[model samples]
Target: MRIQDAGVIFGILGIVVMMVIPLPTWLLDFLLIINFSVALTILLIAMNTKEPLQFAIFPALLLITTLFRLGLNVSSTRLILGQGEAGEVIHTFGSFVVGGNAVVGFIVFLILVIIQFIVITRGAERVAEVAARFTLDAMPGKQMSIDADLNAGLITEKEARERRRKIEREADFYGAMDGASKFVKGDAIASIIIVVINIIGGFIVGMTMNNQGMGVTQVLQQYTLLSIGDGLVSQIPALLISTATGLVVTRAASDSNLSQDVLRQMLSYPKMLYVVAGMLLLLGVFTPIGILRTAPLAGLLAVGGFRIQQTKAEEAIKQQVQAEQEEQEEVRSPESVVTLTHVDPIEFEFGYALIPLADTNQGGDLLDRVIMIRRQLALELGIVIPVIRIRDNIQLRPNEYVIKLKGVEVARSELFLDHFMAMSPGIDDPRVVGIETKEPAFGLPALWISEDMRDTAEMAGYTVVDPPSVVATHLTEILKRHAYELLGRQETKQLVESIRNQYPALVEEVVPNLFSIGDIQKVLSNLLREKVSIRDLVTILETMADTAAYTKDPDMLTEYVRAALARQITHQFRPPGQPMTVITLAPNVEQTVVDNIQHSEQGSYLVLDPAISQKIYQSLNEQIQSLATAGHSPLVLTSPNIRMHFRRLLERILPDLPVLSYNELDPSVEVKSGGTVTI
Candidate 1:
């Protein structure tokens, strides 16, 4: 062990040994001085700490100090009864300090005990208990605040974690202080009992066993003086520690230490000092107390208050001048305009009436829901979603909200806070009457119904959802639709670094060696654009490593990656034991797309005749409408070679439609033909 650690261990052992072994008077005197010095040091530290957690070890220290004092008492009591003297320190406290009078010394000791045990210790104990209870009760609210700050980007993840740790430490410190305060109270009671035992026992021993021809009166005076001195010596340190405990438990967290906070806060208003000064002067003049005694103090107070007022006025003027100078500098600086060019990746802005949806105090949980949305998207999309910036905008209507992606509005909707949206189940019921509307997410027929009609809507086979749920659902779909735009080269590098921790060789071989971060980002974005999960990055990287040698085209590489993730895509569209329903493209359409492909220096493109493109779009629309009539999603199945080209043709008309090649389907899954698209 290190020297410092060993010394602490040995010191504790020595304190325990002091209770058992009889010590010399000189050694006892030295220990008594050390005990007093340690107590004074503790009181000073308690006053200097700005917050209680700064002295987190105080509870344990209190236990150790109490034990040390008790050991000293045991040793001193033994010496007093056996040797007729404890130490020079105790004798001086008895004779010189108290004027050789036993009754006066006893009264002094009693006063110290009353101040510590009844006043300081009792109040500190109650404060500690209440503080601990309140700290524990406020934990949930504090945790939510940290999460809100994190979601708002006000603090980093590491800072939020550190804040949470501090809150827990505060709770623990107060709880321990609540129990440790009892030690000081118990020590006070033990001191009184020990003093009585020492006096009574000293009398019996001095007169009978070791009297040396002393009488009862002389024996009583000698022993009583020593006993009271011992009580005083012990109680002095105990009283200092009790005061320290009161200071620690009652101190609220602030930026400054005890003295600085007291001066700054108590003297914040200089006018209060003037009122006290006037009161002092009035009392001296009206009563017969004589003006000479109070006039000097009153004059000093008035001067101090006047100077403080003048200083505050000067500070206010200085601040105003500084602010004006800063404004002029900002107007002339080029960086001020440059800062406005930056845009958030994702933003959700609502009108004034929608404030309660994001405010925790008003029962709003939108911030918490945003956090969950990010986590859910991360798990499902295999990419960390950027922090969504949410704020209020006055230009929008009270019920309107807009979702923006990279400074462009992608989706907007309106919500009725007091009503629930209930979508009909195709069999409309006249009993479920309400305001007609459409579901913002899917544009399905819906009605805005009241809280009382929620059960009625459900009973009538309508899907009922609250306003927050509607907003959350709509936001989730918008993010999924634009998940590709959120993933950039930086985000791709983060994913690569995460993979490198586990599969270092695989990442080193694929990234920067065969493909750059931008190349990998493009492939990932292409997958996300089609609503495919990129969570299986390992498999995607392996596929890129295999095909990167022959092709530098990201689209081709993405196609190869999809074929490798056939099982994932198949499971996504076709559930377990369910046949996949899809519309098949005719041979003519597939051949025409393959035939129109032209290669360039940049990349390949499908240059189809405008008439052929129109005919193809019309054919695909017919199939989609037929699928919708049958209550099925529109999924197009095409040849492996023409799948990318066909998807590009339908990108503008049916961006959300799922297009898959035969190679991207698992062999075990059965495919059912829903219809055919022909031109």
Candidate 2:
């Protein structure tokens, strides 16, 4: 049996031994005092500590026991040394063992104490069991983090709430049912039987002691136990101790919420057996000294049981740490990806990259093979792309190739025609005749016009290289380099100037001419489209700056100028759909919006999409400036993407804005489908 189980059995035996053996009066006094001290210590600390202080229990009990033992020795020495008369001792002993103080009151109190202990233990056990089961259902994983829940709009919010409620209700129902059944069938009946038997036995044993006169069983005479009228007055201290032992045992057994049943069992393994044995031996040693009058062994049993109970608390903390580790590992496995919300801004940049594809075999001539390759590339990358093939004298731009294979008759005919055309009247230059025939003269360009010219190559795909050391790699390298350069710089001045001078005609022509969208948008579009910039963000703080000046109903003059500049630089290069992180700010910070912009983690030092972040920064700066100009204290607006307003911008210096006041909001920003409204 477990150590705690052994303690319980030993406690029962100790109670029996007290009534049957009728321990010495001095010994009974020692038992009473020690029991009362142990009980009071338990109660005081239990009521005081917010969390159970397992370490305090042992020392507190020991100190109280030592103090009481010393007090008992001093008081008992006076009584044993003939300090009182024989008649007085006889009257006191009879009153203490058989009088009202010991019989009715003690019996009533023990019953109540046992019942209270049972209720407390059973309730705590139920709570732990329910909590363990609840944690199992909510284990953290990829499914819990990234997948759209009703809150995210991937699932309906109503559905998510309903599911959560259903789980809570089901758990509550099962827990309540189990608790009710266990209490009714188990502890309730056992408590009634034990209390009744103990009270009856104590009464019968006390009567036997009354007949024996001032013997050891006559508790009041030989000891300092209070005598009120006819019996020994056992104070609140002894009752409190017995009740405390029961309470501690119940709490120790019942309060585990660990999901691992095996661990709980290990923690609860009773160490109380050793303590019980030690207490039993101590009870015998003290009994010979006439210390315990009626229940020397009972005090030892209660103290031992309480000690074991205190030691079990460490198990709860250890189990909690174990559970967290297990759950963390389960959440991080390969199949699961942890999608973290950006509490603060985070940015990553990638430069140019080319991916090669697997080769395929087809039974086709060179020209057919080339056409097939072009079709395959288009299918893989999801775009219709231009391909250039170059070999001999004829140069191929995109979608064109040249070959220089000699031909006999056609070449001779072309030479004869060229000579005749040189002598002809209208074709004096000989070039006009060649042009009329859709051919070039000798020493000028000419083509044999083969029906089997190579259009596409099948087996392999090629990548671009910078500097074009090998002719084919040049095109890709140039485009990749342009993208990388765009990340760092704001605009290309030459492209901006050209687009500004040309307007619509240039905008239309420039887009197709550029290698990538970032190239066109970063340089040209900045000059023509909405020119959102850091400088524009700074302008919003001006005195009397209009609230709508940043976006929606911007004053248009400054906004338009920035847009025009952006159009010149980056109109063709900008990417679609801006992504934002949640940012919160301290309420008291001045210039909340503009100050936080420089530190935002939304982009790398260089960005693939600067226009998006630039626009957000500008709008925030303008709002803060507008607030300052209006004479309002700066207040931060928190959202997935934040807007800060510092009313009364004119009153304060612009350089004093506090940027570090920004913070990443919890859970990040919530984004939903069909959420964007185009302006």
Candidate 3:
């Protein structure tokens, strides 16, 4: 067993031993001294405690100390009543200490018992009972406060748990104290009874049994002194313990210990001390007598106030000097330069005027909206988006905001804090009066309008959105478009860990075995780049495990994984009960691209003739335009072999255009050939 557990067992056993077995006089004397020391230590600790909860074991300790003292009392009573000499310590306290008088020591012992039993123990017990009731009654309010802090994001789950644990401990400690306070009162009553018994019974045994005809004076004096000494020793320690219990129960929780808290509060206003000192000086001058006493006391008060002020002034100077030194050190340190070397993955910066929209206190739902956005991305994109740092930049325009990806601006926009954005349903406008502008997300012609125009704009079949909603929608699209860039090695590792919890075998076999995390991240990134949700990660990795045997290329592995996840890939574009509209490349164009394809250790590339490449590009652009005019985002349907190559060719020129292989689409998804790209 542990030392603490062993010590607990040993202490209880020792208390029992002291009660049942007679101890030598010296050992009994030593135990009595220890009992007094324990009580004194408890009182000091109670005074210095910052909070009752800080000394949670106080109630239990109180009970143990009470029992130990009772045990010591029994042992000492046995020694004194039977032997007529308890110990040197008791003799000194009873006779020599009290000028060889028994009555005075008896009175002292009775006074100590009265102070403990009637005053300290009674008060602490009442306080403990009331504290327990109040704590139990306030539990719901305290719990609600903790919940509020958690919901406000002021504390983490771990911190919340810690706070809850502390509340429970407080309740239990006070409840225990309510019961344990009885031990002290009982010990006091028992001490008085034991003293009486020792005195009455000792006199009978000493005079009648031992001397037979001994004088009453000698017998009474001998037994009475020892009894009084025993009572004095027991009662003194009990009083100290009772006082400690009262101190602990009465003290209010604070950051500082009792002494420090008392000093700080009493002297918080040094001017009060100065005022009192002035009043004392006036009294000394006007009063008829005691000027000597009053003047010196006033001088001391004034000097104390001055010293307090001087100490405060020095502390403020020291703090300011230390702060300046720290600032200078930070400027000179290489750590700041080292910090600059690292960058946040995503950062959202808004103007000062737009602060209220993001500030939690100002009713900005932006932070909360950002959390929802992250969850949405995690579910849809199957990637954990990095923490998006939001900050205010005074350097930017008052109405403008910037979203940075890897320390560079990817999207920037301006918002009119006083108005909403209204967009026409199509290219046509209903002649609603508003400021003409282009939408940031889609470049659609839009208008900024006043709150009064919102109802009219909606009635005219226009899509209207408030400023915050507009920002949220724009952010959603931005996160979706750049999901690939955010899926780094670290994010991949997190994904792997999550997957391991569910599919340990698959993750264990694939990661660091078939491929590294970087390789996995690359494949996942490639899938995301095509707006494919890698949510079917099990199938994706399984496909990768099968395909990786032949090739180690992440690009080739991604294509195979996409083919394996054809159903998911198709569901994204081809909604249920909706036929997929696609534009196909002509057979000759595909063959010509395939014929000119070059492959080496670095993988596939196209080396088509410039004229032919230009012709193909133009044809595809024309078809894409026609498809756009028809209000459809048409996919480029090509043979599986040339799909990747054709997509690679158009990546730079037509990056937004999606190219899919025939095999990668669900066979059940009806395909309508919108047009043909011919060369």
Candidate 4:
């Protein structure tokens, strides 16, 4: 009846109960209990110990042993229950009997064993993973962030003083737990010890029971044989099933069509379920040798799928990189073509002329000069050319200033041809792909075009015309068009420069009221002054003047002057009477022009809004009411950017009425042209 005597009595009764009637779930419950108890003991010891190694190494080993035992028990039971007699008979016939290949059967058997091992390993892994989560969840976030110099517990005032008396240590008082090392060491030691102990204890117990004549050993021995044999046999099918199971699980985790809850439910089933399915399917195959071929084929397909995914990802990445590289290349390439010409005069009418330039070392000097000239032209034209295809023939006359000649020309011409041929033997040869002709003057005319030119024209749905006809006459038109496209107007550029030059006094006065960032100083600086040609100056000035409207405060006034001057220059110089302000502008204005004027709050400006003007015509009823109301006797508006239609309301209303502009408007009146503007 004493406490010690009572404890002994209870222990004996408990052992009797366990041995007599084994519960199926009892093993699982017992293992979990042992696992938690072992963990609790180690955790308490770790908290008290200064060195983590004391608790770290032993505890993890104990847990692993518990996991292994649980997995072994579960796997054994599952294997026995799930065993298919039909499947085994099929495996036997297909592998050993029909296939006549014991090697294949043995391999299949080994695979099954491996599969069982994998299931056990997976269960063990999952247990460990869960334990890790528990450990992390219990850890204090702030403690986790503790510095190396810190200890497991905060240093007490007394302890801190004592520690300070000694040398300062670099490492923390509570060293980090070597989880992996402990895991290995604990599992190895505990497994070996427990296994040996169990085997020896079972043998002793068996002999003792036999000597007692209880016949307990006979029953146990039979069960032991059956369990071990079944355990072994179970492994063969398990191996194939487990492998298939792993793949399916991983894929489901990645992209399952099932709802999350459904997927979770499916996952809850022991992964060994897949192993069972795989084994059944494998065994059902008529030929056991098929497993050999089927396994490797399946494995190869899995590997190939992974490789294909990787290759596709890499290709997409490469394509993105190549596109970016091309974009950068386009940005960096020069804008226009300008090189030495070698085409004969007769062929010049065809548009493009080739330059006779060789890649030879000696010709580098000429090439450099040509490149310099091309660069200069690009800067002047605000364009960059990418390619220069040179011709293969050239005729160079040295230091000759002959205007015209009769008889002397024949001898001179023959000598020139001979010299030229000698200089370039490849010239005039039939083997050359390019043309070689002689008649009249001969030289190459440089052509320049910017990428922007092509892109801008393309956006407007127009073809890119690089080399325009009537070079001399069209040069002005080309400049105007380019200026219009880029700076809004050709005159705007000229106006800004004129203001910069003629009104240095006015610029100094009004500039302070204009530029906000002080950048206007550069625009005003004589040092920044470029000796731009008349044409280029006009373009630059116009672009600069247009920016004035948008310039930060301190710039509004100067911008206004620049715009007014630009307007005047575009109009062609005119002297209207100072007393009257006659603003003879386009009648039906573009919406954009109207918007800009409406927003130009710096000063009042005159504009005929197209919408309002059209409304007036609707009210007037006459065909030319819109034009007449806006004071446009003969209405005209035409450009790629602008299109307007006006009925002849004036002619319909009063055909004999005097024409307004020709009669009253000043002949010296200036007009603005080009760009997004109204007539």
Candidate 5:
């Protein structure tokens, strides 16, 4: 072990040894001084610390110091009774420090004991107990706050963990201090008992066993002084330690140390100082106390206040100048432009009237709903959604809100805060009539009804929802639609790292080795674009690992992955025990698409004539319209070879349409052809 660590062990052992074994006067004097130095050091450290946890080891240190003091008392008592003197230190304290009067010395020692045991130690013990109880009680609330901040993306995972750890440490520190304060109280009582024992024992030894033939008065005077001296020596250090304990338990957490906090807070207002100075000067003038006595202090206070006022004024000017300089520098700096260029992945901006929807104090729960939206999307889409930055924009109308994707406005809507949106169920109810509007999310014809009409609307077969729900639903749909755009290279890397932790070998085989992160990101983006859930990422990666050697194209790989996830895709489109209704490509259309397929290094595209493309589009629209009329979603079922090319062809016109291959359907799924797209 290093010398410092070994020294602590040896020192604790030495304290134990001092209690039992007799020591020379010089060594006892040295130990007594060391005890005083240690107590003073602890007090200084307690004063310097801004928070109790900064002195976390103080409880154990208090115990050790108390023990050391007790051992010294024992050694001193032994010497005074056995040899009529402890050391020069004790003798000097008895004679010179107390003016050779035993009674006066005893009174001084008792006063110290009262101040420590009754005042400082007692108050500190109570404070520690209350602090411990409150800290433990507040732990759950503090933990929940941390969790909420984490969910809201106000803090990162590391910060949340650190905050939790600090709370636990505070609890433990206060609990330990509650038990440690008792040691100081007990040590005070022990000091009084030890002193009494030494005096009584000293008197008996001096009068009965002395060969010098000392009288009662002389023996009492001699031994009483030594005993009181010993008491005073021990009590001084104990008092310092007790004061240290009180400071520690009472100290609140702050950014600065104790002295700085005290000075800065106490002197924050110069006007208070000036008023106090006036009061002191008036006391000196009116009171019987002489002007000479208080005049100097009053003048000092007045001058100090003036100086502080002047200093503050100077500081304000300096700060203003510094701020201006910093602003100028920031404008000139290239980094300012760089920061302006950055954009959030998703942003939800609302107007002033919608503030109550995001504010928790006003009973709004938009933030909570946003958290749920992120979690819901993660489960449904298999990607962690980025934090949605929410703020109020004065540029918009009071009731308007907009959702932005990568700095571009994607969707916006208006909401009447006090009304409920009611959408009709096919047939309009004249009784459920209100301000007409369209649903922000689905653009369905809806009515903004009053609070009184909510129950009537529902009873009239119209679906009703609150303003917050409308905003939340609208936001969820927008995010879901643009989730693929949010999954950039960085987000893709995070997803890869997440899976790497669990399936390292599988990730190692595919990522960067066979397919780079960019290649995998493209494949994932393609799936997400088609409203596919990549939640089963391991299967996707495994599929890629198997077929990566044959083709590096992301489109072809996505096709293989789609086929691999046939069951998921089938389950996604076709509900359980339900027949899937889809439009199938005609033989002629399929052959034409295959014939027009052109391949190059940049990947394949269908190079069809404009006339033929128009005919194909018209035919596809007819089939899709028929399916919609039949109350079925438009899904094009084509052969595996042409599915990817066919999707690219009609994506601009029918972006939401699902193009599934024959290989992408599960065998057990029942498929009924809705219509055939023929040209």
Candidate 6:
């Protein structure tokens, strides 16, 4: 052990030695000072600590202090019995306290013993017992809370582990305190027994051996005073330690220590203090013997109350001024403007009247709906959507709301909270009349009908939905459409960490070695832009890792990932038993585009003339319209090399159209040509 740790050991061994060997008067007197100092130090520490576990070493310290006091009792009793005196410390303590009266001194020592052994020690022991049981019983719940925090990403694994260790230490501390309390009770009883024996034995020794020349009454008086003084010196420190034990055991867990908590709570209401001062002033005037004492106390209370009120006001003003200065600094700082460059991935702002749709007290479930939307996307697209911030804005119309992606508005709508959205089923209309509007999700004609008309609308085969459902559905659609914009390098890094558990080898081989996180994020974002599911990430990463060494272009890498995830991609647009009817480019049109494709170090672009580009755009639009009218999603089938360029050409004008290459089509999925795009 280091010298610091051995100090405790040496002190404990010194206590054992004091019990066996006799010490001179001066040394014992100094040790007496150290003993009282240690006990007072323990009490001060207990009062200042915020909670019990903060003083985790107290139980062991309690054992040491108890043993040291017991050893002091044994050594002092020996001195009084054999030498007819213990030390000058006890002699002076007995004389000053008892004033030469043995009866009074003995009574005072008994009172201290009664207070420690019967009251403080017993209560502390019971509290420790209950605390230990409760801490042990609550361990499972505390551990589960830590685990939940870890899973929710509120805390790291290291923090959770630390919390678990603290709980165990708490349980151990309480259990040890329960046993240590007994030592205190035993020490109190031993002090009484030792003191009684010292008085009897000291009187016999003084009469027979050393003080034979003195009378029995002188011997009895001298030894009795010495015995009471020795007992008082030792038990005083014992009393301090027992009180400290009770204090630490009874303390509740808090951020503030005992003194701060007491001051904060007691002085919290200056008005109450004013009332107290007034009452004391009244008492001073009404009572005959109270003016000198109560009047000054009343004056002090009034002064303290006024000072506290002034301090509280000053604190509030200081906080307000600091907040204003911070606001000014933020507005003037260039870095503050730069900070706005990083935007919230998803933002939902509503007008004043629409706040109830997101507020829980008004039966609105929009906040919960947003969480469900994220969970649904995670299950569907295998991407963890970033947090959606919902707040109110007074700038828009009262019933209007807007959803934004990366600080840019993607979708906006207005709703009537008192009405339901009613849409026609394309069958015969029953002519239900209400406020006419267009459905925000699908843009079909709809009406904001009243509650009474809900039944009528349903009877007419009309679809009905509440205002919250409408907003939630609109948010869901917008988030799904712009998901590609949300997937950045940071999000991809988190995904890589999550995927490392199942595909450790793939992640190790690819990330930062063959391809960086940005490279992987770009490939995934490209696929998501075309409404492709990244749920089959194992295949996506494996395919990219296998092909990234030779082909560094993310567009080509995305094509390779799409080919590997062909079954998943095809299953979304086409079922297993169904033959997918797709519009394919004619050979002449495809070959013309391929022949005119220009490539340079900057990047490749289609060099087709305006005439050719316009004709191709018109023909593809006509084909897509025909396909949509036939109730089939438009998929342009082409060769792999031309797919990326062909898709890019259509992206600016017809961004919603999905273009798939032949290699991306799964072999198990049946396919058939719907029509040819000829220009």
lDDT of 1 by residue, 517-596 (tens): 99999999999999899999999999999998899899999999999999999888884576888999888888888889
Per-residue lDDT for 331-360 in model 3, tens only?
Answer: 899887887778999999999999998987
Please report, in order, the local distance difference test score of every candidate based on alpha carbons.
0.91, 0.34, 0.86, 0.35, 0.91, 0.87
Per residue, candidate 2 scores C-alpha lDDT tens digits across 1-679 of 6999998667556654554443455565556545555667756554333222232243234334333433332333323322321133323543444453454434544554454445543454455355436534553332353223432335555666665654554445334433333432243344344334333433444445454454545534222222221112122443343334333322322243223433556435456545665666666667774435424565655665566567556667778899999879878775445444212111111111110111124321333444554464334221222333322212222222221111111111111111221112221332122222212221223222111211111111211111111112222222222222222222332233233333544444433443233433332222222212222222222211232234322222323333333432232222224222212233322233444444333331112134543444455566665645654333332322222222122114332232111232212333222111110
Of the candidates numbered 4 and 6, which has the greater lDDT value? 6
Q: Better model by TM-score, 5 or 6?
A: 6
Q: What ordering of candidates by TM-score runs from best to worst?
A: 6, 5, 3, 1, 4, 2
Q: Residue 72 in candidate 3 has what lDDT?
A: 84
Q: Which residues of candidate 6, in runs, are more than 4 Å off?
A: 1-13, 49-67, 92-228, 245-257, 270-311, 329-342, 352-365, 389-395, 428-430, 498-509, 532-552, 559-679
Mind giving the per-residue lDDT tens digits that candidate 5 earns over 174-255?
Answer: 9999999999999999999999999999999998899778899999999999999899889888999999999999999899
Each model's backbone clash number: 0, 72, 0, 28, 0, 0
Worst 10 residues of 3 by lDDT: 493-502
- Candidate achieving higher lDDT, 1 or 4: 1
lDDT of 3 at 39: 86
- Flag regions of model 4 displaced more than 4 Å: 1-112, 116-200, 211-220, 226-245, 248-679
Tell me each candidate's TM-score: 0.63, 0.21, 0.70, 0.22, 0.73, 0.75
Q: lDDT per residue, candidate 6, 153-179, as tens digits?
A: 678989989999999999999999989
Candidate with best TM-score:
6
